[model samples]
Target: MITDLIAGLFMIAGTFLMFLAGLGLLRMPDLLMRMHATTKAGAMGIGLVMIGVALHFLEAGVTARVLIIVLFVMLTAPVAAHTIGRAGYFVGVPLWEGMLKDELKGRYDAETHTLASPPEHQNKEP
Candidate 1:
C-alpha cells in the first residue's frame, strides 16, 4: 500500500516536471535556454517516471530494466544538450539579449574552427 502511494507520487511528480519542461521550451527565447529546459527537466521527469515504474513492479528483472533506462536517460540527455548547444554556438547562434556575459567570446576562431579556454587572468570578474 505504501509502495503504491509512493509510486503514484513519483509518477505525478514526473508528469509535472515534463509539463514544466514543455512550457520552458515554448517560453524560452534561445536555443541554449530551450536545451536547458528539455535536458534537465526532461531527464529528471523520465527518471522519476522510471523509478515509479520500477517501484510498482517490485520485481528484480523489471526493476533492473527500468533502472537501466533511467541511467541511460540521465547520462545521455545532458551530453546531447551540450553537443547541440556547442554546435549552435559554433554556427553563430545569437545569445539572448539579456545575457550578462559571454565567456566564450574571443575563444573561438572561425577561420580555424577551433575553440580554447580563456587565460586564467581573463577568467576573473572585476
Candidate 2:
C-alpha cells in the first residue's frame, strides 16, 4: 500500500539522520560542535521515526503516544544540549583551535557564573 511505502521512506530517512549524528559525534573536534550535531540530528531522527510509526499503525492510541514522545523530545533536546554545553564551558572545556569568534568571550563572567547583557549602545541597530 501507499502508506507502507511512505512509512518506509520516513524510517529510512530517520535512520540516515541517526547515522549522520553518530558520525558527527565521532568526527567533530570539540564538545560543543559534537553536542550540536548529535542533539539536532538525533532529535529530528527520533521525531521522524516516531511519525512514521504513527502513520503505519493507523491507530489513535499509538499515534497519540508517538506524538507525545516526539513533542517531548523536540522540546527537551535543545534545552538539554544547551545546559550541557554551558556547564562544559564553565568547567573549562577548550574550544577548537580553528574557531573564529567567541561571542561569549567578554559577556560571561567567570566569577559570578553569569552572562552580562551587551551594552545599550551596541544593542542599537545600525
Error of 2 at 33 (Å): 0.9
Where does candidate 2 have its weakest 10-residue lDDT segment? Answer: 101-110
Stretch of 10 with least lDDT, candidate 1: 114-123
Q: Report lDDT (Cα) of residue 61, candidate 1.
A: 100
Clashes of 1: 0
For model 2, the stretches where C-alpha displacement exceeds 4 angstroms are: none
Residues 31-51, model 2: lDDT tens digits? 999999999999999988998
Instruction: Give the alpha carbon lDDT tens digit for every residue of 63-107 in model 1.
Output: 999989998998889999999999999999989999888888988
After superposition of all CA atoms, the RMSD between model 2 and the true structure is 1.2
lDDT of 2 at 103: 76
